[model samples]
Target: MSTVLETRNLTKSFGEVKAAKSLNVGIGKGEVVGVIGSNGAGKTTFINMVTGYLAPTEGDILFDGQSVVGRLPRDITRLGMARSFQVAQLFPKFTVLDNVIAALVAAEGTKASFFGPFTTAARRKKAEAVLEEFGVANYSRSLVSTVPQGARKLVDIAMALISNPSMLLLDEPTSGVSIEEKFPLMDTVMNAVKKHGVTVLFVEHDMEIVARYVSRILAFYSGEIISDGPPQEVLRDPKVQELVIGHHLDISILGDAT
Candidate 1:
């Protein structure tokens, strides 16, 4: 229950628009906090600032009680915080084993030694273990092109997990996967992350996913947090209902089955 991440008066602005406004939030080790907000609610902006993709206009971010305001994304990651992109980032032509080895190499400051002994038995064993946890070990020798989009996402999550990050920042982890695949994928993720005792902060659109996975919810609207509490309370909040959840859950998507 120790504090893992904390933000104080966090703010981010792009010219006339303020994407995140005076945000203050805290997450503890092993906590899973869900972020729900409309498209322009600054959920992504908040994440960008925390993960070092964007600098805060004012205020500070503390990771494990240390200031991290001016650090770069890679530096932030090296310090045990890893981020997952909304779109799956993978090398389509590379073998699954190679893709993971590449991440390990980069993590070890040997990204330049692609074909070197960097992919030694030890690294391969580690990479293979992550793949197995994601249920994609069978596809280790397969090229990325041959895998399904859902599996690709699992791979992306596995890649992030391989870094052994202490805190994970995921932007819509289940964005492109099918409804049937979502729970299983998340199960894989939850189990693996829990094994590492990592804290999670994620932006997601699905209420069902939020209820199923998150221990708490932080709802945002127009670059501000409207509610921060348990799933039931946040979902039942009037401001959250009117601004983000209600209208959003009713939207029509091509694959509404998910």
Candidate 2:
């Protein structure tokens, strides 16, 4: 249970708006953590900063005990961190397999040579394996634009994982997926992460999914973490219930359902 990621006084601001305020947290290797918040609560800001998509205004980020401040996203990926976006980041015109091949090429730092001999037998094998792993093998030959959103989300995560990252951040993995498909999508994702032993930190809006999939929960309100602990404890907290989970829905129903 060693700390694989840590943030100290992590702060981000845009003009007068504070997106994240003095955030401090540590994530352990192989742990599955969920982040929950309403709009503008700084959940995405934390992910962006940790994954190097956005630089913090001030404070520090350490991955595996080394400072990663000011590092580019690609450099951070090379350091064994990878992320899937809330909106699936895919080349819509590319075939599902080709998209993964492109990711494989980029992960190899050969983006310039991507079109040339990049889809060799070995690379193709790897890409196919990734597609199968994410349960998107059936869509391998289809254009990304033609696939369902759930399949596209799987493809995006597959591409991120093809790099063999030790830690993975998923922004709303179940977003845009049908209610019936959410559990299956998460099952596929969680199974894949377990197979690779990758630490996971995901931002999700659905309390049921978060409670089912994550070992720990971090509740955010007004750009600060208001609760952090086990699912039952955090979800049942008065502040979390009022500010994040709310009393409108019977949380007990969610607990039983999950």
Candidate 3:
């Protein structure tokens, strides 16, 4: 498989603290990879740097074989890379359909104005289609804040995908979703992404979710990757079990589940 994204000696620092240290990794086109780490383990920092939300103190990011370091997030989005936040980033007051229409406007790179005639009938039709694809069409008339967390997350992912990005980075996609809802939500997301053939890198705290969704895993610990391999191999690594998974997950059970 060809590489879709790569980082070389990526580093980020806040004064004396290094949130991400010399990180180097590559994601293949169409690969579904999961990122696992505890809080402050540099997972978000890695995503932030890759998406241009935070300028790395050192190293380069390549997207679709072009250097993207120092590029703005909007520029990166235009380059076929888009991301969703850990918390669903949405306009709480706007109805779900309107939020999607707004994303469509942003994706077109047209300056949005309160008095501008941006939301044409074509835009509304496209937004509704996207909502239906993500299985959130029922919540279209509801305010985002009034929707369930899982639905809100689906909306956020849909917005990221509005630009037809080749790569989608999801930060803690299952976080805040109820346990019963997590699998179905992810199934919708995974099925949609697979249909579009988009590469995925998601940060997840749920072991079961990670195990089921990703073909490979990157285990992060203290600003570095402790293990990188197939889910079973990485989860079974002693270093990963000791440092990342810790006492919370039993490796044997995870092994059987996979």
Error of 2 at 164 (Å): 0.5
Estimate the lDDT of model 1.
0.87
Residues 1-258, candidate 3: write the lDDT tens digits. Answer: 999999999999999999999999999999999999989999999999999999999999999899999999999998999899988889999999999998888888888784678679999998999999999999999999999889999999999998899999999898899989999999999999999999999999888888888999999998999899889888888898888888777555455443
Query: Tens digit of lDDT per residue, candidate 2, span 105-149?
Result: 888887556456767898899999999888889999999999999
Worst 10 residues of 2 by lDDT: 249-258
**Model 3 local distance difference test score:** 0.91
Off by over 4 Å in 3: 252-258
Write down the lDDT of every candidate, Cα atoms only.
Answer: 0.87, 0.92, 0.91
| Ranking of predictions according to lDDT | 2, 3, 1
Clashing pairs in 3: none
Q: How good is model 2 by TM-score? A: 0.96
**Per-residue accuracy of model 1 over 46-84 as CA lDDT, tens digit each:** 999999989999999999999999999888888888888
Clashes of each: 0, 0, 0
Better of 2 and 3 by lDDT: 2
